[model samples]
Target: MKPIVTLTINPTIDLATAVAEVTPEHKLRCDAERRDPGGGGLNVARVIRELGGESLALYPRGGSTGELLERLLEEKRLRRWPISISGHTRENFTVTERKSGREFRFVMPGPTLTEAEWKTVLDSLSTVAADVEFIVASGSLAPGVPVDFYARVAHIAREQNAKLVLDTSGEPLRAALEEGVFFAKPNRKEFRDMMGPQVDEPAGMAAAARSFLEKGRAEILVVSMGADGAMLTTREGQYRAVPPPVKTASSVGAGDSFVGGMTFGLARGLPPHEAFRWGIASGTAALMSQGTDLCSRQDVEHLLTQVQPTRLA
Candidate 1:
């Protein structure tokens, strides 16, 4: 099987710490900080690696934070190809309240990429995507990047005969769907925004997803419902997999882990329904981990046995 390729337009150095509580204008000491390479696609790639699969990650690098991101990936021994940009990479801060175990995330809009810089990313994809079986374009468009960027990525994937596994939201996601893709994963909030609030119920959401499939916009759609598990919609039918309960440490990377597991199963030639189970298992496993630790292979394997998906009428 060919290696999976993942692209993250706006990568970040994730900084996490714990404090007794969060209050305005009060100086509070924090626990030792933990830094990790973060971004939707990067997290997916990391999860794939954890599941014993191979993937090549592509992302832009800039400034000192970019350098740190590279070193972090190296420590994890993830294969990567970095493109240089003039703007500084962004850093996201996560604070966990020790008393309540609640997490507060502070996200920054990533650096603005110049036209040339953004085009360089497209050019790189065109060059390396030919032999890959799947190309995952996840995360947000950075400042100065066009909304149609993922649409363009879909075009490239189609040209290369690769399955495009896309995860994003808003205009970029809508634009990409216009170009069509092999699979898409959106959280419930993002799904509501894309398909309208009227499609909030399961039946309505299924109809909306099938409509897109009929139009050739996408072959499969999965909506991550956080602790409620996920819903998978394909042309053949619809299914829902609710994960077994686990105490959620943090919900940060659950979506990415789901994508990674499902994509990995697909690459291994598993049918869509069976692969959907892998996604549910991996996502549930993520809830069991702390910070950005993501899902462990043991946990995923254990959860896989517990997941029993039911067909939706």
Candidate 2:
């Protein structure tokens, strides 16, 4: 097994297409479609591979869509271990309006997981936890799973001395935070959802992150502000990064790319600030592609030169 591992309880096959205009009650014909294996941990693994790193993607799969998802992952050559479930995996659709440059996303809640199935996931992680350097568990919880699922994963990470990097929201996020994590990233929208609308400003966001850091809820609290940029707060100090200007085709997979790049840098023994710079570059690089295409190594390398991270403290 590779030293880096990612866990995704809910996975999906992302289907994307473009249409000229969206009108109510109109049968709008879309252009050719593209499908990709998606979900938080899977996307992160893909980005790590694009950056010349390897990770084992552990997720649950079921039915026809699940088979298609595996085939897509195979196409990307992602090292994966997919657990079989009774219900079919979900599919997410994205439609881009060419005229208005607007994107519409429709998501489905994934299949339910039985207690035995969820325990199997934990068992799988337990077997590999000590051997891995990081356990990245992201995405939303499916039905039939407890809210403390990630917190349970966090405990395994702590027990194995592996860093837990989380990218989730709501009660699952809060539960994991109570267990403490090495790194936790919540996009601006998710941050707002968790901390309320009052914490939307930069300073407010920073203060919120600082509170978590001071409370030992997380060693590093990163609030990812789409387009605006990202801020990182730690006990040592705080830093902010502004991504270089790039025309965006879609914001899909950008945050996952950030997690992948930052984890890749940290796994290579780089410090948090430098790792965060890599994250910004990766996220910017992701914007350089259309649809679900993640960041390429070349684009990331080039963008890394343009990333300027500032010490806020």
Predicted structure with the largest lDDT when compared to the true one: 1
Q: Which candidate's TM-score is highest?
A: 1
lDDT of 2 by residue, 61-176 (tens): 99999999989999999888888888899999999999998989999998999999889988898888878888899899989999999999999999998999999999999999
Error at 217, model 1, angstroms: 0.8
Model 2 bad stretches (over 4 Å) = 196-198
Give per-residue CA lDDT, model 1, range 190-228, as digits (tens).
Answer: 989987875688778888877767888889889889888
Model 2 residue 234 lDDT score:
83
- Tell me how many clashing residue pairs each candidate has: 0, 0
How far out, in Å, is residue 153 in model 1? 0.2
Q: Residue 94 in model 2: shift from native, Å?
A: 0.4
TM-score, cand. 2: 0.97
For model 1, where is the 10-residue window of minimal lDDT? Answer: 194-203
